[model samples]
Target: MKNNILNSLKNKFEQTKTEEKQIQQYFSTFDFASNEISESDRMFLVEKEQILIKQGKVNSDSLYQICITLLEVSDRFKNNGERKFMKWYEHIGLNKDRVSELLKRAHLYINYPEKKNLISSLPTQSVKILTKKDIELKEVQKILELGYTAVMDIKNNITNLNDDEKIKMKSFKYFDVKSIQKIQKDIKKMDSKEIFNAKKEIEIYKKLLKEAEKQLEEKEKDYDNQNNLKLLEAE
Candidate 1:
């Protein structure tokens, strides 16, 4: 019975592999960008995209490929291509948000081919978190080590925190003394005008820092008062 089950699973895997190959072959030959491409041909691609989406595990690479194709097809449409794309995308019964995300992932895949291995290996949500506008490449590599759920949780927690808490959480990273020193050290390379601009910027930053410190002190005092009230209540 176990052998029978194993053989059945093997057959199903083979069938999927065959289907993927045939669809990919079709994709390669089809002039999806041609203005003359029929509605039936467009629907064929849509059907294939739906099949991939409905799979138990949609591979990141396949999803990105389909997104790229869909966008390309949309561009090929002479009139209201974007509108047509949206109509087809909705017809596939996918979330518009999800479509936006997949397109972003696909663009990231194209733009950062060096990081393609890392991006393609992660789930869509993890990719979304890692590719945030403010997340640098080093941070992406570090969080990639934590795996999908951890990356998502870390970003979600950061997002959910209050402004003060967010600032506190990222304070260490934001205040990289070494980076500051590097900028200071590079000041020697600046010409007079550049140096003047840098000095002005430094003054502005100093004022900002002083304001932040004052606000922090106020918050700390409020926190202490809250703690004291809690202690009195307990008493």
Candidate 2:
């Protein structure tokens, strides 16, 4: 009975692995961007900016960073403020023109807070730049976390199918040889720029995965054939 249970569990595990492989194969044709931006990338940029800012030599790159940070904060505040503005506008039944004006003012207020008077006076100036930089870094971190959540959701969706169900779905879809050929032709003819981008991304990921697998295989082989004799001699 224990042996039977173990075999059953092994079979289930193999089935799951097969299903995941099939799902990956289907998406193998689809290309997606790397979708990974390391925390180190952001930290390096922050450090570079800090050096330039401290020197009080505002280069175009530093200015660009400042603009991007402001834009990100402005977007966040605008989105939140718009929701609140809409609610109040509906509650008060404000005139359409008045509401529009209020929204414009709200955006300006959010993007350019009254507290940062010195920074606003000289937007290009880098004095006390660390405060703004910290805010931007936090926003970038939040955005990265949100992106990770989205990727996890996609991964969950892809891996949720059972082996039999996946096989059946693939089989039924490709039942007629002619129909399968036509579908392939249609996919070939699909001209969306996004599709092309996805295809490129998929190829890149496949190459990366291939390299990783090769390295793993080499490591496994090395482990299996490790020089135990040499180790004993050393001891």
Candidate 3:
């Protein structure tokens, strides 16, 4: 009876593995991208993550480590602030834990272009960065954890902001109305050219804002129309 039970358990495991393989094959065409994530693709990601978890392939700590390492090297993720992070996360449609894992994976992919296959592998989360002293270290994730904004500030050759500039521009998005009023007051302290440039930027932003509002209005109308149709059909 024990031998029969063992055989049954082994068969069940094999069947599960086969199912997981088929699931992966179904989504193999849905390539990962920040902007191109559709509802179906998002569901696929969540399902695949679940299978990976059941198969003992998901490693959270190591994934977090890869993310930290990427912050020190890559520039692809929207780590600029909590707002950007949230928007990006929502766009990707990953659950919190999966987001954290894939976020780390995205970071590693950006920073370590040479290690793409290794980084994507479930068991491999190793990261390496040279210190100022040029020593190669293995335990890199033990260092201080940087916030979302700080991670977004990681610089590269094509990056618009340098290290010092990124620090200076760390963020003004959290400024209060009073602080903004103070900024308005201080703007007169600027020279003429700076004021002129600022005015041009303000005008451009106004136009863009109007366009965004128009787009939102159209979307709302479409949603309302769909809801009305649904109600009529129910009637």
RMSD (Cα, Å) for all candidates, in order, is: 22.5, 29.0, 19.7
Best by lDDT: 1
* TM-scores of all candidate predictions against the true structure: 0.34, 0.19, 0.24
- The residue-by-residue lDDT of candidate 3 on 1-235, one tens digit each, is 9999999999999989997786666544445575678888788787877676545433333444445553543244446565665565445443344444445555555555554444444221122121212322222222212111112222221133335543444454533456446658979688988888778877886688567655665665465345334423543
lDDT of 2: 0.42
State the TM-score for model 3: 0.24
For residues 155-175, write the lDDT of model 2, one tens digit per residue: 223333345533444456424
Worst 10 residues of 1 by lDDT: 223-232
> For model 2, what is the error of residue 41's alpha carbon versus the real structure, in angstroms, after optimal superposition?
49
Task: Tell me the whole-model lDDT of each prediction, alpha carbons only.
Answer: 0.60, 0.42, 0.48
The TM-score of candidate 2 is 0.19
**How many residue pairs clash (N, CA or C atoms closer than 3 angstroms) in each of the candidate models, in the order given?**
0, 1, 0
User: Worst 10-residue stretch by lDDT in candidate 2?
Assistant: 122-131
What lDDT score goes with residue 85 in model 2?
46
Pairwise TM-score winner, candidates 2 and 3: 3
